[model samples]
Target: MKSMKSVVPHLSFCVFLLCGNCLAAPPSPEALDACMRGWADQNLFSGTVLAAQDGQVLLHNAYGMADYNAPIANTCDTRFRIGSLTKGFTALAVLQLEEQGRLRTSDRLATVMPDYPHADTITLDMLLNHRSGIVDHTTLPDFQTVRRTSPCALARTIETFQSLPLDFTPGTQFKYSNSNYILLGHIIESVTRKPYADVIQRQILEPLGMHGTGFEYYRRPIPNMALDHTLENGSIRRAQDRVMQNAHASGALYSTAHDLYLWDRAFRTGRLVKEKMRQKILSCDAEYRYGWATTEMFDRKILAHSGETEGFCSTIIRFVDDDACLIVLSNLEGCSMGRIIQSLSALLFDRPYQLPKKAPTGPQASADYGAYVGRYQIKPGFFIDVTTQDGQLYRQATGQSRLQLHPESKDTFFVTEADARITFEYGGEGQVARLVLHQGNRDFPGDRL
Candidate 1:
């Protein structure tokens, strides 16, 4: 999975706010529309959004173009490849199967896939909560080439990473790995003697009337589907295609905001799974449950998840106790779903919020840019490259497209295309020695490499 650079920081806070008794009324439709319009006008957002409270729709709208090449406008019904948001559905499928007595969360992986490496040590519950030690297949070195090639058979896909060393001992650590869900998908198929897509279609989509949703596959014509796009060097362009089958249960589903709202409603009404299973899905015992992450925002409990794939980004935030939810589905990759979701949450709760504004354009030239032109290590395998191209400053994270940085101040630079800011720090020797990334209300410090 591509690191949701801006969203991961917020997941770390997980603040449990107690505001049930003091919950604010939902924002007016006009206010919410205006807020989204501001983001669309600033090119910070492009897609569909839906917000609701206490089972009442507060706002549902679409913004910007669905297909820039075709000049097609986005509509509330336009479907987007929802990326990792599909994991929630996959989790739901697993829980539903358990409810049917076909499986149990406590079952060992060996019970389903006996030959899988370390299968005896991992449990379904561990995979459900992302405590499985399986390395994320998407992070493997050959994943890029694999995704571009013809879809591999499920067994082949499993074989590619099945023997790789575990990232950690099973159930001993929490690491988000798409391989867990892929394995779950395989197990589901094994138990039911059916394909994963067929099981999901029969079990969830049909029951909830989510007619606009289905598995995304190569060469399939999905009506009203929005073509994914990405921000490249400050310009929006079409993203390369991936064989969605490779994403499998991890991220192969496509749906509309309305369809996703139906999904949220299903959880609220306990339509698919019983109350006990629902609680298991939302339990905060593990920071992540099933496929959703449990976090606290605005003094209310939140069941949320963010999704990112080639050129699509999506997020769903559920204020569960309040029966309130927010869904954003975008075709443009690198759009700051975290910032947009935070602002919308603030507006929904009647808290102070600011609509996006044009990013400040500082002096066109800065001689100091030379000092910041080096790679900085954020983590063992992640680094940010600050470089100059034709006098413009740019920043690129490992394995990500470069984005131009506009000077916000002498030591601070901001990315106009994303809700990200960077500040260069000087060492005792007066040399630029480190950089800090500011996004999603958190700061990530990186040392010069």
Candidate 2:
């Protein structure tokens, strides 16, 4: 067994066949915990979840190991890096500064940073709501390369894309961009003449007594902090450390699931800012507010956000109308976070929720593997190369680690790396012609290329 040779011991799973059917569901909330534990026992899940209603704590628990090396188990208080969820903190700080009459939302970026391109036309309002027309630095190939190697500096990072043209007219359309929040972080610094971290600490974290949350520093050790993990080539490994400056104000924050609940509670009680300002932040005029995406779930107005970085993923959903909140934080990336959040919300409302089941596996035919082994275009410029080695199949995305695919049926396959499934569509002649990758609630199709 590979377990003998690898640092991470091979996982052992009980075959709870549930009568030979992979899915045995309509699980109660308690059963949901068992289902989640089942995934963890299979070496599939690692994280914490907190669900509450009307200021009442209903469910709070953690699963899997925080540091697989130290073998530290995750707890409700274990801190995890929360990718873009930091945007909410960033946006709140800006709005708080506005409430203090320190800055106005209509202020032009050019007024504060003269060198920024189109600063005259882009307003603070635009940056807060992701209508600034700035290109997402996170998606740029060069930025991605540089970030992994070194700590990104604010000035140097902003200058990298200052001269570039806008993706659209300012405020004319909505486009999510990391550059927007990075710039907002800088603006916070400029207005207060303090480090963004210090300002955030003073404004939000300190005020709420959220001692468990703060900025992430790679070299600085955090007690009870879960080591981030990433899936690479069908194996789980420590997530690569990047310069904290790379994520900076945009995504560098870390917090526990419970602390995030305090965050949500702050809004509920109007403790974060004045009611009028808070209302502005919660407005759904444009499908998004300062740091939240506005949407309807179970016919209730919900403000939510999800975060994803190299080794971490997180989500926070606030049912504004129902006075309820659901938060999930993870050290592992792409662990089916979206579906899990949705299912938890449903269970809370007495809606039907099917428990997660193991993706079934079956024997492959003589030519079964060969027909699906080929390169397919995931997007115009992205491709997934499917290859087999030692009679086992694996898939690699562009610039990403490969994962093995387990067959549930003849044409369908799934992977535990992220609850992702793939299926090849057959043509009239029977050879595969197109592929579909399904995870959570989204699907991406790829034509054989």
Candidate 3:
């Protein structure tokens, strides 16, 4: 044989050629570290983050405080209520049951829960893919008050939305409904003859060694659990608490970034389910599949999901083909998670990314302040009221607390609490006509009423 060094070099070149764009170099940990540190210093993020490639961790760190009142710092092991990220676990449990021949995806809802209205027309697959047309229970009129006051069992939760008419014929359209997953949770319990939480603990968490993950309940003392916070009126405050059981299988799980990393790795290594079943979980026949959303970013396929509750928001993104993943678990609600995700992903792929910038302070007083004060209708029953107090501008959405708007330019202002900007547009007479809200890479124009 030729020299071993020459052979190694040839093998490496062939591997690169075979893998094509999938073989690009992984992002530097230092770069990711610097980006996160900048965000934390700007108070843009709190909680933990983990990034990994090819089963090896590149950056695993925590930032800000776990409990702002106690001034306790967060660690890598800090657990966070992951909101809708719990759906992924619920989905996986369903798939595992299928693998065990407990139930088939094609089974009709009537076959499982015969009493549900229109059950005969809906299939389990429809629920899995969010094509079931079931109304989202969380959108019901009493959801906020009821969820905060009491814990509703799955059956009682089902009663909240069961009688509501379907939004569309099952399997003809896709509509994301927490009710679908809640029903799946009930099915899991019914078929296994065990509580949904127990099934998850025994089948998934224990086997994957994810000891830090579990369902959350009200007032449960979980060690190192981060207290949820929300940005309000340009200040950080504790978020309003909700009864976790109300979230049910839809969004009640809490976990750490490290444990979530293990969750991602299990999917990659086929440790959770066989390869065929894994593909089924990740299938993109619809925009939503088995609790994850399938999409592409930077020309690479991505399986991602995000969760938001009263005081917490979380995200997990997996570049399945490249074996790379990013997990962000945050306690502060209403923060710009999209901006953070996009920036981190850009750094990961060597694309252009920007660091957080300090909010600008414009003049102490401006004559235009009075002109900008008015209510603009964004849509039906939704309005944004702009007002000035003590020479500072503020914007308040319908039913939300007023947030101070920092002047970025003569007619444009930014909110320090979120990655959002507002621009005032004037009509021919120099009168304010419309305003535009720029956030999360989208623009919403609100006409002056």
Candidate 4:
């Protein structure tokens, strides 16, 4: 890898400390600070950043305001809702039980969650690996309203989803679903005869010395906790708090940068689980392994996860073999967390990444819009259909209502309904080959189908 001196002349002095390549020195603290400060100034990042290598802290800093209303500046100890990052911890608890011969990943869901719909067909492994085929009940109607207004019971939550059929055949494919971890949390309680919070605390949290992290309760008051805010239509507003039980082990937990750093060390060194179980958590046998998504970025094997609730977003990526990690927690909604982490990763590896820029406006006129009219399969169960009606172009997803695609550039389209942008790509023959959907700071690629 080369330095950014040539491409990004301004960041020539911002060299990063990294592993794998020894010719260059580790990224300086100044570099990380400068990178984060730049992002904070642009509203692209807030909350915290913790980066380390070989068990050494390289960067641990907080930026932006935890409560912009009072304008309390965030600190390293600021607690932010970790959202789905909690799944990795939940997965570890289950693996701990498995190591004790109390439960097996191969256990049939029916054996534990007898009342759950289609329990006979889904296995524990399916849930862990996100191949359970259960519909993510979170996306169902009234889920948001009900959760925001009341404390949701696990049993009641399960009942609401039980009437719904499986999303697909169990173990046949992968589609990440929070419903899986929620059920796993229930199963943990059944097997250990303890609350999910108690089980997780004893099994992982307390053991790892993570005192600043635990289950988040909607009704509870947490000291120094970051308030979640959403940026909408160019206005920032408070986001409603949802029931913790609604998210359960799937997305309800919260943590600070320091405590999460302790967790990373414990997880990476096998102090928390057996090497085999650790491998299952940190490496991929499928699109998702246990609780983490397996990915390759710049040819580096990385195990990572991202989380988003109403007013917050988070991501933790670990390059275990390279002894590196990036944990970002933000209390601001629609903050470009995806792009922030990607930029940080690029800096860590000396790759070229752009700074925040104004969104590209739509082209003055539409040309050959008909070329993008087709169905695209983003993944096994996800899709986007681009179609034209009369003289206008539109996009639709499986089981979703059609949305109009406002042309930005000739080959680019933006969706205002949920703040997404799509840029179509062409192949050698000059026809549409793929499209990348940019939303929530991450990119999803859909191929012509």
TM-score per candidate: 0.89, 0.87, 0.91, 0.76
Clash numbers, per candidate: 1, 0, 0, 5
The models' CA-based lDDT, in order, is 0.83, 0.76, 0.80, 0.76
Best by lDDT: 1
lDDT for each residue of candidate 3 in 113-147, tens digit (9 for 90 to 100):
99999999999999988889999887777776675
lDDT tens readout by residue for model 1, 316-424: 9999777889999998887767767876888788876555446654657767689999999999999999999778889999987888888777899887666678999
Name the better of 1 and 4 by lDDT: 1
Give per-residue CA lDDT, model 4, range 1-449, as digits (tens).
01000111112122333335323223767777777776687555678999887778889999988988898988999999888888889988999999999999998988887876788888999998888888777777767557545788887777777778788999999877777887898999999999999998999888888988988876789888999876543345677666655688888899998888888888877898889988776555465787777766667887778787767778888886788888888887666665567667776876765444433355433457789989999899989999887666788888554766776666887754344779999999989998998864567899998
What are the root-mean-square deviations of the candidates from the true structure over C-alphas? 4.0, 6.5, 9.7, 8.9
Worst 10 residues of 3 by lDDT: 1-10
TM-score of 1: 0.89
In model 4, the runs with Cα more than 4 Å from the true position are 1-26, 233-235, 358-449
lDDT leaderboard ranking: 1, 3, 2, 4
Better of 3 and 4 by lDDT: 3
